[model samples]
Target: MRKVDLLDELRSEIGVVSDKCADQVNDLYQFVCESLQKKMPGYQWVSIYLVQDYAFVLRHDEGERILPQSIPFGEGLISVAAARGSMVRERLSGRVEVYMPFYRGHHLIGVLVVIAKRANVIDEEDVSLFMELASLFETKVEKYNS
Candidate 1:
């Protein structure tokens, strides 16, 4: 398969984002994570975490290893995006990680994290596009939850 660009892949699925009901949102998370892992070059894993009780709970993931059930909502590799409400690009060990937050209006609800198997597979531009996509998804979420 041809290497896919993150922005292009997300744009191609513009119409695929469906209802943001509780159950449907979970399916959407799984779908988005699976799609990213399959199509995005160097993206070895993808996960979406929802926050509750001041922590992040891994709701969906597409990868080999299972992550912890929950993590404290603060400074950390996975919590950076949700903590800051912005995209964070960091190089840990040798892998590049991009963390994007899912916010509804001003309240943060979750985080989308893409882990790259290779160094520098994703960059600032990719993060920007991902943020926009997250915003679109957030709109649906906010509409339903409010």
Candidate 2:
């Protein structure tokens, strides 16, 4: 939204972060989700789903509503996004859910789900920003996991 100008700042916020946890990748995911929700008020919920064992496993989430901890490979919007390797924007009754898939090389890493309380909240610029965020998340995850 209007926070587009905060791109560099947001990037820097997530780029140089390192958490001392057993599961650092998930910790980074949680940090990114929190940062997104705090910086973008339009995002009522933010969650990271890692592709593990052919399923979308919920690594971390920061939001008002609780979500499923896991989704089967071919069950829902996450599956659709993963299949296409692109962002899937869905407008529901009261919210707009954007499922953005990111990768490490040709391998799909995970999906970043951002939910806004109002419909039509995601636009072209937002999509671009989300892609950048997903790339940053992928880089951080790769570095941490390796």
TM-score of every model? Answer: 0.83, 0.83
Which lDDT value does model 1 have at 78?
Answer: 67
In order, candidate lDDTs are: 0.74, 0.81
Cα lDDT for residue 35, candidate 2: 89
Q: Can you write out model 2's per-residue Cα lDDT over 1-146, one digit (the tens) per residue?
A: 34567766777777766434334667677788898888877889899898889789988888885458989899888899999989999888788899999888789989999899888666777788789878877776677667
Worst 10 residues of 1 by lDDT: 14-23
Predicted candidate 1 versus true structure: per-residue lDDT over 12-123, tens digit per residue: 6743555433446676777788777777767878888888888888888887543577888774776767767788888887988787887878888888888888777886
Error of 1 at 56 (Å): 0.3
